[model samples]
Target chain A: MNRQSLKLSMEIARVHLVSKPKQTIVAMLGVTFGIGMFIALVSLMTGLNNFTEELTMTASPDIHIYQEETSSRKSILEEINPDGLNLVYHQKPKNETTKIRNAREIARLINLDARVLGTSPLVSSQVFYNYGPVQLNGTILGVDILDEDKLFDLRSKMKAGRLEDLLSNHNGLIMGKGLAKKLNVALGDRVVVTTPLGTTITLKILGIFQIGIGVVDNVRSYANISTVQTILQKDQSYITDINVKLKDRNLAPLVASELQSKFIYKSEDWQAANATYLTGSMIRNIITYAVSFTLLIVAGFGIYNILNMTIYNKMKDIAILKAMGFAGVDVKNIFMIQSLVIGFLGGIAGLVIGYGLSFLISKAPFNGGDIISLDHFPVNFDPMYYVVGIVFGVSTTAVAGYMPSRKASKVDPIEILRGQ
Target chain B: MEPILTTKGVNKFFYEPEKFQVLKSIDLTVNKGEFLSLVGKSGCGKSTLMYVLSTMDTDYEGELQIAGQRLTGKSQNELAAFRNAHIGFVFQFHYLLPEFSVLQNVMIPALKLNRYSRKEIEERAMTKLKMLGIDEHARKASSKLSGGQQQRVAIARALINDPDIIMGDEPTGNLDSYNTQLVFDIFSELTHTYKQTIIAVTHDDEFANKSDHRVEMSDGRIVKS
Candidate 1:
């Protein structure tokens, strides 16, 4: 507890460490490499997880609420025997419907929830697009243009023309780039869409957009809700799906389950739809931590080896220090201080090196394909990883240095002197 | 004057190779300000006796009291504190820490004693070095000094805490005749001028014969005192 003693002990530790330059450098390098890799790999793993989450969020709605599918049954008669004495009738499902009866009221109630950012009612139909001898199958989605734009941030993805054009012109349609290409049409061209219910509607192409995903670009087109409803012979309040965007994307699963439990609707969150990606991120995190911790422990063993050797070489010095009236604990403190010094300097050096590595990797060129959102290798510069590395490094070095320091303290000055 | 250190019926055994007694039962006392020499041929147990008296070797079966305190059966920590406060040791090897400055080496014992602040310890260490005529070399590492100069530094270190007794095991063993005589004169001045007690083990007949008192040992028993 004496400040002078502590200062003297630290001085002794510094002297010993500086005396053996080669061995001390090797021990420090071991720790530096361990901690540096720890920060680098952990940050990269975290960044990849964030990237995956961002992409998943962009490609799916935060929440989707829909009517549960209802099964219909028909009675069919079958022979019971060859003599046909008795006949049996069995009920079998022949139809399924998923149309919400009063979707406008449900949308209104959802909008009243404080957590809801926006909600858009959707009536999607499987249909065929025909333009002068060319035909293709796709989906015709009926949506309120402004509401759908708020839910999907659709205006930013527009390739040509504006999404507002659909609002001004009732018969106007917004088609994906791939769908417009298949019909050999451009903006202001007319195309006929035939629904499965045998309703044909002519829609003028108001805008074209590409979401970068080939499947979505090739098969999706949008029209105003009222026009599609009239053509499909549906009630004004009819809607098959409601897309809900929340203020906090992270709370989507919680709110989805809450809504589902309170109503008869089937609600799904984006996270639930892509659970595998989240689990993959969890597994990556576990692997990163395991590898980093193992390396740090290995670095600790390096410290142990060097310190043990230093104690063995300094036996005479230890005897002399003991003779000078340094207590066992004080002698131990001297060597433990040596390890802590190495840990401290090495931790700092590792953090700097890790930050440099992360920055370099973040700047490295990467040929991003159609799937990923990043132009370069993603790296998260989280401060917590560096903090963790420092704590782990220093503590592991202390534990490793303890055994050798204890040995140094127990050295018999008399025996060493007499042996000489 | 009252005795500064006393040992009664001190016995030591070595279990290595065989159980052999090193120090036989011996009774000894040295008064305050006494300059004493324990002299014997190699393996005559003079060093073992000094070890036991210095409280560095506690395996001996004996009753030991130094500076009016019982030192026998004390823990290693207690013995360390006792040694720091009351007994200082100078070894044959002049075992100064090689990596430290001469002044820092001299200040270590006093720092461990915790009797003074760091600045005060440094000043006391400088005075001890000046007394030994090594003040100019205080800033240099101990290992950079000559064998004789390092021994002088070691002596300065022993005197820093101003203990009741300064014990040396062959204090001039590694030095030439000039340095040996110089060490002898320093010990004489410490005992006569400063009223400090010194107990040194020596093989040199001239060094032993000139001391205030001489205790010669043979086969672990005191032959002459």
Candidate 2:
């Protein structure tokens, strides 16, 4: 209320807070903890998601453009559960009964979409291999040999021979290095693969590849589409969906939707195709939000108690100031200043602590195993987090200190003057 | 000389859900450069009247004026500004902020104006502390000083704003006899040298006798002067 008096009060509070070690610690701890927790939680989720997206999109099309559109992953998950991906990887055998009359024409239509930068006819078959008792059931994706290697890095990794071997011979196959080692097979080794639909195909293992990602390393084999169709008894009318690539990974959704409308077909983004991101993020949010709010509640109580004590301890001083021409408004400002000082210090410390811990967590090996297929956790530091944390810290501390500071302002000077 | 402060029929009642009048329609005028002391034992309305005249409490019935400005119904902020520019107060206990140095404590009042340069406020605070013979304590924490020295710091603070009137409520109440005499001499020299108006409340008769005039109070009313 009083400008000059209020300024004096603020100065008084500022000095008191800085000079006292206990008050300074009590005031800032809440702010620091609130901001720190917010930063750590938000950054951790964002970082991990970016990493997963990078790894997924770099190896595959990141997103695949197909000639049919709906909630593909959700409907598949409901229908098949853990085997949901099986439907996506395996195609119906191309027989006289199974092949549609216009399948190649439909694929040709799909190739003409504006966003379809590259479209390869895919003929996929699930094959089972055996050597004594060692067996591995895998899916072989057959695509245009030259186009597939350039559009998908997963097909380019060949541990034993050139990836171009898939194009060199009519019966050539490029199997996963892990799958080759498991079956005790080598280059030029002749092997018989039986499709799930009871068709047998013969192939010479011309090469092997290790995609570095566990998902592709152990469970996939690649061959040219023409060879797969011929061995599986499929005519030109019979083929799986087209594997489409886009120019920009970020604009995959735009391209997916653009092609969907152009060809009247369905497309799948990686989030929908391999949706661990959405599911994992939902679970992480429930945990982080619940835990951070609980910690802030605890910090609130800490600040409230310290502020209450500050009022009680400084009652005499307040009364004295009131008697000496300082206004009640001025007294209130003193307490506010004290809380502000605490928030300032705690904000700095908490940011330092939170970011430091987050940086360490990112480098730590958290994502692994055949399921994760990643070597490191993602840690991304956005400047916005720091700004939000500081503001959050200051506001929370002020709110926690408001009630007691008001009480201090309402003290009666004469009652204290009489030593009451 | 202009009347630095005036209170006409000033009656102050403390209503804690009941009425108990503290000052009974008191009329008082303090002239510039005059040193006046209110002397009384406990249960006297001396301190209550001091708060009233300082413009800290304007809730009383009656008209009060200071330096040509009406005191009643002015907003809290306006009153605070007026108090900063025109009134300085020294309480019995040296209510110094322990975190600030003696010089900083003195500058607190001057800083409220916001017009003075930092250098100017610093010089003013230093100059007053030196005149009070406590210049050596300018940078020392107020809490570290003896009671007498701290009281001198309080006196220096009151003078920093160059207020029109200074009010002291038993300024030597907590000080020893030696510090009491030192504070009294400072008060005497203040009016004699600088022509500063002083209104002090004291329970000490010797301190009251040294004032230019003494107003004695009893039963929550000023009875004799």
Candidate 3:
């Protein structure tokens, strides 16, 4: 209870641990390996998760607003008298425009809201790219190059020319690298495009980009809004889609619902669009924690085993100490201090080793091939993980040491002395 | 001389291996500064009685008092503190912690007592070791010493706290005749020259005959004093 007694207990503990150097180091290594693996696995897994999340999240807007075609199959007879049983055998599909009315006005109004970071209008249509003798299907997206760059950071994804080139040349288009490869076209090369309306035009390639998604990279291309409007033969106000980026992406679902009700259009948030990927992320997180915790607990058991053996070996010492007027608490403290010292030292070593391993992993080469463009493995060096790892390690050892220390304290000196 | 330790109607039982009585209504008293010995055959409860008197065994029925303080019904922690400050013990085996130096082993009880400064405690420990003629080995590990020297170190440890009474459970049981004689002389000097009270349990008749008073026990009861 007093400082002097505690000092004595610590002294005894230090001596005991030092006496059996081999056993002490073995016990410490258990914790060291457990915590080290925990740090490495958690940091790498989280880093990968963040990398994948950014790849998908930044490529698409937080909220997408577009017009959806809907046609009711109800006949005129049913509309006049709903109770009457009226059935139409073969219902004809109704023709409706997929373009949103007043799309520019909606974008401007949505941008005025404090939550909205920016909004970019897009006019996209399916087309066919014609090389000399080869033809491939693709989708052309018409966007204001500067606004698109602000929303999606398009400039960084550019592999060849700049967005400024597309803006300057009216007939210029930026093509995905995969599409460019397929058509055998490079920057400043001319390619023939046939629109869905059978309107053919020759457009010069201004830039080449790669978004890392195979399907998108193989078929998607970018062009100026006016050029796409002229190719589609639509007026200046024609817009098919509005992409909304928010300051806080977490508010996307709520804002999307509000926009849907206000504009009478289909509004989809990124989470809803990528529900499967979110579930996969959650599963990966669960696995990471489960494995890390198992490693730590195994390490804890190692400490427990070593402490128990130490207590068993030192039974005579405990009895003698008790006989010398050392209290039960003092004996317990001596053993407890041994375990804590191991935990503290092992946890520190684990942190250092974990950092070293993470650094190595971050520099390791990664070939994502045509699917994703990455040169090195991802590893996040978050300080919070280190704090959590050490705290968990120490507390685990404490719990593990508790039972053996209690047994040591409860030892009856009389029994031991009598047996001797 | 005034009585320093007294017991009235002390009784103890062992529950394991079926119920059996170990100490039966034991009543004894020892004067201050007296060297007393409890002698009996093996399993006659001399050792059990010693444990009870030393406050290490509290499972007994009767009043036990030492240095005019009733020690019955005291908590284990309180009894441990009392033992640290007031009573010392010398076991049959020289049970020194193998990893600690001779001086640290002697200073353990005094450190637990915490009444004196660390420097003062160290000085007292050194004095006790010198008095026992083991000062040259103070810095050596206790386990590295001979049996006689280790027993002497145990004696020094007992004396470091200046306890009122020193109890021994066959302190010379494992020693040869020469070492046994050395320990006997140490106990005699501790009592006569230092005016320290001592109670030892021994099977050696010669050792018992020379003590100030000898108490004999048979089958858990004191037969004669």
Candidate 4:
């Protein structure tokens, strides 16, 4: 706590470190390279994680709200398993219907949330597509074309025609590229679409989109909300689902849970629906941190070995210091301060170098076609990664330096002086 | 005058390899400002006794009182603090920190004692250096100085805190005859003029004979006083 003692100790530490140039630099190199690799690897992994998550989120809505489920036949069957006989039973409930009448009101409430980016009410129905000599069963989605484009990135995925055309023509529809190919239809072509309730309507194909998802591209089509509702005999307010997107995709699960509690709706976030993928990412993060810390500790060992050798080499000096009335803690502080200086400098340099490496990798041009639609390699530039790297680097250095300092403090001054 | 240092029935042993008695039932006392020399042949335990008296070796079975404070059974930190404030040491090796400037080396004990500001310690260190004729080399690294000059710097470092007692273990053993005489003159001046008490362990006969009192030891026991 005394300023003069602290200054004296720091001066001694600085002299020792400066006098032994090779050993000091070598010890510093351990931390430098350790933290460098940590920052670099963590940055790349974080970038890859973001790349993958965005790829997944592009096709999926951030939040999905479905018609609420009350205790029905499924719950009854689960409750009465009938003496553990493992019997398979089926029950149909009269109140279990797909249409939610207040879907627009729920969408309005959700859109009021600052976190919500966009929301759309959708009506889904099983439909049949028929040409001159072919018939295929598929699913049709009723949506407002403009809101659907904002929610699903529909504008960028269009391969033929325009999504805006669907707004002007109520009888027009957009089908996936795979569906268009199967029905032998092109833009401006007419197809007879039959609802499962036996209502047949002829609709012109206004747009073709390919999302690269096998199931959706093969069987899903989109029609104007009013047109699909008329064909399915539903009121204008009825909708089967509400698809919601958030300003921050990471807040989806939180917002979903909030909405689920506040309203009579079943809500799901993209992460919950893809639990396996999230778990895989979580495991990868654990592995990255484990490896980073292990490397830092190894670097710490390098410091430990150097400091231990310094203590041995300077045994006479240590003894003399002790004889001059430097306390054991004072001796220890000299070495501890030395290692901390190394850690601080090394961590800073490592972060700078790592950032340079990340920038270089991100800027590298890629001529090969990307299957995930990324034009170049994806790298995240999150500041949190650097903070983590520095914290781990400095602490590891302090811990590693402590062992040698303790040994130095316990050095017998008389024994060493007499030996000389 | 009251005794500045006292040791009652002191005994010491070394446990390395086997049990071996080093110092046996030693009783010694020195008055304030007295110059006393402990002289003996090799393996006579004179250095061991000095270590016990200096409060550095606590393994001995004895009670040591310095400046009227009980030094026996005290913690290492307490002893170190006590040594810093009251005792100075000059060793044969002139163990100054090689990396530091001579002035810095002299100021270390004062700095550790925390009784003065750094600026005040620096001034005190300069005064000590000037007294030893090493003030001109104060800015130079201790290792860069000549052997005789380094020893002078060591002595200056010892005197920086103005200790009550200056303990020396073969303080002039490594010096040439001329430097040894110079060191003996300094010690004589320190005791005669500055009223500094001295206790030294030495194999040098001339050095022992010049002191005010001599205690001779043989086979771990004091034979003559």
CA lDDT, candidate 2, residue B213: 82
Mark the regions of model 4 whose C-alpha exceeds 4 Å error after superposition. Answer: A62-140, A146-164, A174-221, A226-269, A366-370
Q: i-RMS values of the candidates, in order? A: 1.2, 3.1, 0.9, 1.1
Model 2 chain A lDDT-worst window of ten: A91-100
What is candidate 3's CA lDDT for residue B40? 95
Instruction: Report the C-alpha lDDT of model 2 over A297-386, residue by residue, as the tens digit.
Output: 667667878888878887777775665556667788888777766777788888898898788877888647655556677776988867
User: Top DockQ: which candidate number?
Assistant: 3
Using lDDT as the measure, which candidate wins? 3
Over A1-420, each residue of candidate 3 has an lDDT whose tens digit, in order, gives: 888889999999999989999999999999999899999999999999998898898677999998777634577778899998787887765677788999999999999999999999999899999988777999999999899988998899899998899888999999999999989889989999999999899999999998777667899999998989899999988899999999999999999999998998999999999899899999999999999889999999999999999999999999988888888999999999999999989999999988999999999999987787788998999999999999999999999998999999999998998788
Model 3, stretches more than 4 Å misplaced?
A: A70-93
lDDT of each: 0.87, 0.76, 0.92, 0.87
Residue-level lDDT of model 4, residues A151-201, one tens digit each, is 989898899999888989989999988889889999999999988888799
Q: Candidate 3 chain A, which ten residues in sequence have the lowest lDDT sum?
A: A68-77
TM, every model: 0.87, 0.82, 0.96, 0.83
Order of quality (lDDT): 3, 1, 4, 2
DockQ of each: 0.74, 0.39, 0.82, 0.65
DockQ value of candidate 4: 0.65
Across residues B1-225, which tens digit of lDDT does each residue of candidate 2 receive? Answer: 678788789888999879898889888888889899998878788888887887777778888988878887797667766777788878877878666788888887777665588799999888898888889878888899988999999898888788888888888888899999999999899999989999998899999998998999987777888
Q: Ignoring the other chain, what TM-score does chain B have in each prediction?
A: 0.98, 0.96, 0.98, 0.98
